[model samples]
Target: MFSSGHLSFKGRGEKWNSTDDGESIATEISSVTKLEVLELCGNSLGVDASLPIAEAMKKHPELKKALWSDLFTSRLNTEIPLILKTLCNSMIVSGTRLTVLDLSDNAIGPQAIGALEEFLSGPTCFALKELYLNNCGLGSAGINVAECLIKCHEAALRHNTIFDLQVFVAGRNRLENRGAKALAKAFKTLGTLVEVKMYQNGVKQEGISALAEAFEDCPNLKVLDLNDNTFGRRGAMQMARVVGKLTKLQVLNFGDCLCRRKGSESIVMNLAMNCSAIQELRLNGNEIDVETAQKIVQMCKSLPKITILDLQQNCYGRNWSILVSHFQKPFVDFGAESDDDGSRDGDTSEEESDKSDED
Candidate 1:
């Protein structure tokens, strides 16, 4: 019975869905003003729909955040700039005070990615905390989003504009060695980022290792998502090795990664033993079995760090509790009894959280 105020669209009995569902959310938001957060995912609403929202937003002038993440959307074969025309024209993208934008799994052209350079040059993007362009077409083109970020960071520095951020999850957006280095270079300079997700990009071991080095120097980033980026066992071990050096990481998702179970376990245990800073661990879809779970348990112990654990769609069962009991981290989305057998518990099924919180 809600339109634009606060709406949660979901199927019955399906718990632990990610709030990234942007589809089928039709709110009578025309008259509403002073919106705090707007999360509509996969709704197939182009930039035109944003005109009304933008105009209304101009009046409300209090809209803090808006998430249009479409995790399941197919890549747009066009270039990145064309896709972003709507954002540049009428939308919350260039607005001030707006934070957190997840445009994951879209095909964004490189030129389009670069076009944002002009946008970021403006004062609008100063307060942005998270800007997710994962799985976007930026990777498809010879261009690299990591490079764009680097350019943006330099622009911010040159302009002397205040920029602070916590999360910058924009992976699965094809980043090769040069591009990854650009990101790492930017990180080395800025100490604001806390969590960075870069899984499924074409980052090689060398590139990840570079990022690890940058992270070690940066002093801020905590959580990292580098799963499914073609990081073989060696690459996973190497990337985890990078994180092991970082003591602030709280969440790490290595599910269905290129690395095998052994490699992943090594990374997890290493985080638990050495880092002791990680809290949330997501290793779902990696095909880890009871044996692997046993190893994970022996390594993971009571610490103030670890919390929410996701082992769903993998191997662990209800008995898996024994391993996670030492730690206070609550387990959800275990997928032990899930009919889908592919879903996880407590995990954001979609990109943006359907859950609207002040944060």
Candidate 2:
């Protein structure tokens, strides 16, 4: 395969858990000096076989992208933080152009998140972008992780320069109020973050307040996801106050948030009143009262920038089509998922996994 030179797995993903014989494949991969992208996610390989293969790719200056999903590889027996430290100090430091890091479903806890917090929180990570930390089980109940981010702020902000950011962190417990509060502090410090997801964490009123305040500063924050959380009336009200301030907010998903229609009304009206930046809005799984649905439909009509509206699972389902018809321009139905428009990237994938939490 190395001699053939048709080395392209560009769009292939692991729907089938095919383990290409590690020895020969690793040898071939190690020799390729011009590889632009490499993804070794979700295979049942041991760290004993994977570490050397990853280390071998370090020599290639042209290597720019990598996806190392599934944390069980390195965390089989070792503590997660130590493994992250090792990976960051070794592979991350050498790849000057490396941009994407997908560490989803590895179950890295608050300790690992805290350890990597310095690596990503401040200015030390300027050239890097696109971080996926989904299902890592971040800390939700304490302030240590949050305090650690504040402690590392100066250089973490100065060096962790990820201008083109697209972060995904979900399906974890550590994203509770304290953990989320810590993350919000770091978000405020960042310069050019664009997208974020912390769905299903226990991010209550205080965390949303912090996020709302931080949201005012992030000039590039366009898409945001806070689905399945505890951000309720006061939190939604806080989000309402500043939701319009984000001139680039295109997509928003607050699905299944136990919030009453008032919360949705507060935010949706706030956005409709001022933010021409919003293109897609999701109120799915909320117990939105019919009055709020009517308000949404009325407001969305004037929103020239809006292209997609999702109100599925809201108490007002049949009326969903009523509001949709008033939209003169093309708009999505409740479950329609257009191109990377909203947070989920597609309706089916998000619906199936919408119940899952994030941070």
Candidate 3:
């Protein structure tokens, strides 16, 4: 079903569990002389099928992008690690320098970290620029990803190559404070990063502070999305300190981050003073009051390039209309008014509402 150097079975809903299925795909892979991109999403791949497909991967040294998300649906937890390891091994052996590797929506937990570690630190990732592992359920094991990336950076340096990773997305992984701190170390080291998105990771003030410090080193960062995380006053202030440094920032999403009144003020003030290239600014569900929202509106007026400003689900109450009128911008998304007393029940309900909105 594949032609030219590209093969894609995306959203096919095929359940490939047998070795025969693997061999068929392997045969097709071997037939492609200049294979560069392989997309295998929306299909369930078992260990049997993965083995042959992985073997075939080695034959195509030109392979650069492996869009392998949602490939292990209905698979045993034990089988996923083996399949992941097998595929990684083949890619490593192929002597190919990958540019984009996406393994999102797979639910590959901590057990799969070993395979990821080996693959990421190997020669295959020397030229990798974009890595996506969204909704992988990595939990605390997420730290391994950062550690392995550091190893990969070191390996690239030793080989006289630059590991200029540009984009990293790992949202909904529950990589709390410890995992965040570890990743901060890696991000600081890989200063070539352009975008970093780690939303819904349960990262608190400590983790946020660490990441803020790390972000100071990445001057090229354009997109920073830490949505649905908890960023209290301390965390928001820490982030505020670095917002002035990221002059190239374009999209910044901190929605549902629980940055209270003081924190919101600090961040808004910094964004107004700094970040002139900012295009989209999301501060929704941050418990911002009318007074702070006024400042945000004023900030938006100063940012000429800003296109989208999300101030939804905050403590705007009836004052939402006033704030909206002041904004004057058509791109502002001020979803629903909140309590007039500015009393936020808790972060749990707010985060749940945010998730439902996304769905």
The number of residue pairs in model 2 that clash at the backbone is: 23
Instruction: Report, for every candidate in turn, its global Cα lDDT versus the true structure.
Output: 0.57, 0.61, 0.86
Candidate No. with top TM-score? 3
Backbone clashes under 3 angstroms, per model: 29, 23, 0
The global Cα lDDT (0 to 1) of model 2 is 0.61
Q: For candidate 3, what is the TM-score?
A: 0.92
- In terms of TM-score, how similar is model 1 to the real structure? 0.63
lDDT, candidate 3, at 349: 57
TM-score list, all predictions: 0.63, 0.75, 0.92
Model 1 lDDT per residue over 152-271, tens place: 566667778756666777766667666677787767766677888877766765676677677776456677777665444555666677777777777777766544466667777667
Task: Determine which window of 10 residues in candidate 3 has minimal summed lDDT.
Answer: 350-359
Candidate 2 per-residue lDDT, tens place, 160-184, comes to 5324444535545547666776677
Cα lDDT tens digits for candidate 3, 1-359: 57667788899899888999999888888888899999999899999888899998988889989999999999988889999999998887889889999999997888777767888987899899999999999997788999988999999899999998999999999998988999999999999889999999988878999999999999999999999988877788889889878999999999889776777778878887888999999998888877777778777778879999888888876667777777656868777554333445445453454344333
Looking at model 3, residue 94 earns an lDDT score of 80
